[model samples]
Target: MTNNLPLTVKRSIELLGLIGLIAVMVIARDIIMPILMAFFISIVLLPIYRFLRNRKVPETLSIVLPILLVAVFVALIVWFFSHQIGILVKDFPQIKENVKQHIDSLSDWISRITNFDDKQQKAFIQDKSDDIMNMATSLAGGAALTLSGVFVFIGLLPIYIYLMLFYKDILLRFVFMWFKADDHPKVKEAIYETESIIKSYLIGLLIQITYMTILLGGILLLIGIKHALLIGVIFAILNLIPYVGALIGNLIGVLLTLTSSQELWPVVTVLGVIALVQFLDNNILMPRIVGSKVKINALFAILGVFIGGSIAGVSGMFLALPIVAVLKIIFDRTTMFKQWGILFGDERPAKSPMSFAKFRRKRNVEVKPGSEKG
Candidate 1:
């Protein structure tokens, strides 16, 4: 009946459905983000759970152990970062002094360019100070809301992971119920491929974080930059969010450099070094590590990140690539959505400089030798 509909009508219906789905996603973003995160994490941890199960571990224990390990690992990262933050806080006085000195230098530079005296500048700032305070007050509220969301996301994550792992069989059954037994082979293959793609993508990301941190931090430290390790780690993790993350990472690294040093050269050096690392990661390391498992092209990847961010903020951005990747795998397997799969995929047109005549001659010559032998 749906197929009998006119193409224009079918497309209109699809467009409506897409709009409705996006609306639902935006409205329930808070509820959705944590579950989505846990789903991906569960995929990443599935192997560990399976390993334990194969060892004849109790079902509950197998589920709980992986969650516990993940919890502990996260706690360690949080603790390490908290220590770094503490050191940062302790240097607030020095940072404040540096800021004042920098401000004075900037003011002097401005005075040289413009006719405004220091007194006028001070008066202008006084006029705007009230607006700044109001802005800060609103920002404080936003910060509190963000904090609450983070707490909710963190608190529910482990619970969701546990439930997902415990009821994975039920979930698999639910998926299988969508098709008849005759389609089971194709369904199972899709599931396996989706699982493979997600696992490889997540693991490759982990490897990326480790090496990016080491290389970026080590290079900055060698160049005598302050907070080199922290900046490196920040960029490494942020770079996980695909195209948008790297740009944000650059902004953050630059901000850190500017705040830490009064010199301009360090900031330039930091940007240069990050660009080099990004070049290496994009061209060499990423392809080797991730392989062809998740071949999402640049356009869709960027659009997905933006769309995901618009729907659910940072969590959405982080989840976007894997979600699209999983969708691509499923779409490629199914008959109806193969066009979407092709759109998401990164298949390039093969090109050869060899002329048709030259190619035919080579093939014919090679075939003639084989024919003679026969």
Candidate 2:
């Protein structure tokens, strides 16, 4: 009992220490988050840096090229979507009217079924509508603030990326130096694995996004949907959030279609397009591209998304899984953090060859007088 008391006290102290660490992290999150994001972006872009260097490109040029490409790509997307965004903003009044009409129509149908008067129905709906609008406005304001922060980060990204890329080797050496000389080999292995995972995950995601965007855009166009490109791009970007993202995009698409076209068939067709794209992403694209790198289980992936959304909003949600995957890699490599790797790992058990005798011995129980032992 005395010995057990000491063990219990030690565990309580350990738990308190962990809680303190978590509190500190939460408090420092705002300052830490951007640097963490910068680190990850640098990791993701490292492959291109290495590839260019190997091809005898100047180190500075190597870093500049990929950064330029990413910048140009982002600029083109913003330019392409600027008009749609403006139209959407301008059409807010029309959208509100359409939404109100739909709600009134729905309320009427419900009232008819329930024998409620139109005034009662309208009152009920008006309250609900006000709540929804308030929530949406709050969300929109938050999103605007987040985008402003992203723009500020973007301004600094080139400098951060350039220095990180050019000095990657030195950075890696410093990391290795932080460990004992004998531990350098293991540190290098961990570094390589971390780099490989980030590069693979990012590049694969880019390809997946491009394919999904094209497929979704083509399908929407074929179905004669208005603002097909806009819808497709929006879906592609949101799809980065994993399961919930596509669903949200689908809801938005359906709402937009409902407002733009009164035809049920068109809405059904849009839903079908979303379903088909989801199927392709799940069965074909993800399995081939992201499966190898992101081996984290679905539950953790979803949890990560939710936590990230809570902390950093959409950008956090978009980055959650990749960050989790990177953390898993680091944990798996580091002796002290191996338990975290196990905690975050896929829950499936590995199959191993079993000896019949050992299995039988483990399962064996003393036979009772009337019991048969198998």
Candidate 3:
């Protein structure tokens, strides 16, 4: 139907379809996020599960073992963080005092700037308290909902993962059946590439998290920072999200330092350390480990992250690049969407990003009144 339509009409239909796709994604995010997360996790665990299977382990045991391992690992992290939280709670009085001091300092600065006495300032604040309280209430409500959603998501994840693994063969067959016999080779290649990319990316992430946790945490510990391990682990996990994650990790480190210490130098040191570590990770570690296996350029990776975040919140952002890479791999193998795969790829030495533009301009140049004959 779209093929018979005018160009503009066809484009309009495509645009509407794109909008509808996004709408469905956002509307169904809650239902989709857990399953998608499970899918990725299952992919990462596939090798280990396969290893156990090759050892003649029972199917149920093979699947259950890796899930148990992941659960234990997550439990350890939670336990460690909970212990740190307990320490923070113990220091609540000190933290409260520090916060109040900061607030009072701000109030005094405001008074000097606006020429309002404390009395008038108090009245102004009192007037806005209703609005502020309403906002606080709304935020608290949102927090409760988010917390509940997280628990539900966590609960469903393992179940989804188990089911995905158990039905893996059926799913593969289903995918194969979607294409013709002649296209099976291409489909197999796509599946192989997808699996390779996912495995490499995930393994690299695990290495990154370990390297960062030790590097960052150890440096902070040497510098006598409290909760160094906690800070390091948090930053390491957050740093998984690429450029934006590092910024957030830095903010978190700064906030933790500021809240923990009265001195200014620790904050500076924390920021400096995070910056230096990020520079090393981006320039040296990541390139060596993850490499260009995904072959996505920086531009589209960042764009995908933002778009994914907008569509499905944090889970979307986390999964965006790998998903795009998988899509690119599949698209590149197919005849119809090769152009899209190219757009998602990084500029290589063989193909300059500006080549097409220069070619177009050169081709459009006229003979210039027979000057070219000379």
Alpha carbon lDDT of each predicted model: 0.84, 0.75, 0.83
Task: Put the candidates in TM-score order, highest first.
Answer: 1, 3, 2
Error of 3 at 197 (Å): 1.1
Better of 1 and 2 by lDDT: 1
| Candidate number with the higher TM-score (2 or 3) | 3
How many clashes (backbone N, Cα, C below 3 Å) per candidate?
Answer: 0, 0, 0
Stretches of candidate 1 exceeding 4 Å from the true structure: 124-129, 348-374
Model 2: CA > 4 A from native: 1-25, 86-101, 125-147, 350-374
Ranking by lDDT: 1, 3, 2
Model 3 bad stretches (over 4 Å): 1-17, 103-132, 348-374
TM-score, cand. 1 vs. native? 0.88
RMSDs, each prediction?
7.0, 7.4, 6.6
Give the number of the best model, judged by lDDT: 1
Pitting candidate 1 against candidate 3, the one with the higher lDDT is 1
Q: Which 10 successive residues of model 2 have the least lDDT summed?
A: 365-374
Candidate 2 per-residue lDDT over residues 1-374, each given as its tens digit:
32455756855765787678557656776555666666777887777787998999998788889889889988988897898888778877777777777777788788778988888877876899899999998899888987787787777777777787777779877887788898788777777777787777777778887888899988898878876777888888878787889889998888777776645687898889988988888877777785465377678889988877776667678778877887787777765456567557663322222633432322223333422211
